[model samples]
Target: MKILNKTMISVLCSSLLAAGPVRFINPTNSYAAESDVENNTGFNVENSTSTANTHNFSLVNPDTNIDVDIKYTDNTVTVTTITNGAEEHTFTYNQSNGFALLDGKIMNLEINEPDFVIDSEETLSPQISLFATPSDKPVFVSPGNISFSESVDSVGKVVAVITGAVVLAKMIGVTLPKKLIETKVQDALTLIGLGSAIALNTMSGSFTYGLYRTKDKFYTGYPGSVNSYQYKFRYQDMAVNASLLGKTMNINFSEVGSWWFQSKPM
Candidate 1:
């Protein structure tokens, strides 16, 4: 009887091993399942590079939405404003300096003073200022400082030779008065001075307090002035790509409308 019971136990164990683990389930539906993940909005990086990046942001104005586009690089920054998907204004700047290229002119940016100030019915625009280009030549001195040292030396030599001749004649009893020699020498010097003045006037045109205009071009009396009037606009951080060697990135500016006048050459 003991041998038969041990044989049955071995067979049962072998059958259980072959069947593996089993799952117990109810015939009726009663349970539910769920996942651990949460829902969220996605994010994206528009333009990414080792040296620069571009980002888009929006500003809500009184009744419209303003889209601002900014591009930042190693040493330069540029900012552009767009409305209704149409470009308005684009401003560019050099990070090393506060100088900006706006409205076809190189402008100096100053933000130390008050944003708005009024005096004597004059309206001062904010952020930037305009300056007139004194002249195409762009000089610190009008007509430039001139020197005629060689011409003066030549005039003096001629006068000396004439004086020596007159003195020699008198010493040899040739009847030439010293007064006459002096008067002639003085007259020659006067003519030289007059001639020099005429030549200078011709070379540089008329100069008032400063050279206002030349034959075909106009000039301003102020320093660092350009051909057109200076325009001021609300300052915005500009987007720039310093890695760009000599290539220019185009940015459309429509905020203040098209440039009123052409930009003068540097």
Candidate 2:
């Protein structure tokens, strides 16, 4: 009976070893299995949603380039130019005074009356200004300056040369007509003296004051002066054409002591 009991105990132990451990499962739901499935599906959906959001963001914004910047205030207008995404030049203009500030320097604008009157009365003589150097300085030119007298003297000399040439030709028995000699001499003198006269005028004196004209207004200013070797002239008062106050002002240098604005070259 002991041997049989021991043998039965051994067989029970072997049967227990052959069978695996027991596991408990909830009848209501398989939470672990459902949780894994849901987690996997949510991860895939999140990835797809993230990709779509990135594509939409790229489409929403495309161009982000800036070239110029302009700002306006009650009294001033500022214009800034940009090159290669970098600031290049800035220009500011004053609406009230018609003055402009370029970079850091101030540009003055002087408005003259319609009658071009100087002092208190209107004058028949017109006064003008010229620029000698490429700089901002201006030199005032008037009839009273020594430079003007020199120009007049130059014309007289040219006349005298023609007269002398005519007399010399008669004395030499060339037998050329006085009018022909005069004409030929005058033409030669003009050709030879044209460059010299221009040089002299440019070097002797220039307009220290700049005159600018707009649609309905005339502007003028001293624009400061420079220490130049050229001589400068000034007058107590001067007059100019009030009608020149139009759009697109041009610098006129037809005469030494006079300047005016015209739509086209005169």
| lDDT to native, each model | 0.26, 0.24
Candidate 1 overall lDDT versus native:
0.26
lDDT of 1 by residue, 245-264 (tens): 12222211111111111123
Clashes of each: 15, 11
* TM-scores, each model vs. reference: 0.21, 0.18
TM-score of 1: 0.21
**Weakest 10 consecutive residues, lDDT, candidate 2?**
52-61
Best by lDDT: 1
Worst 10 residues of 1 by lDDT: 202-211
Which regions in candidate 2 have their CA more than 4 angstroms from the true location? 1-66, 95-99, 108-266
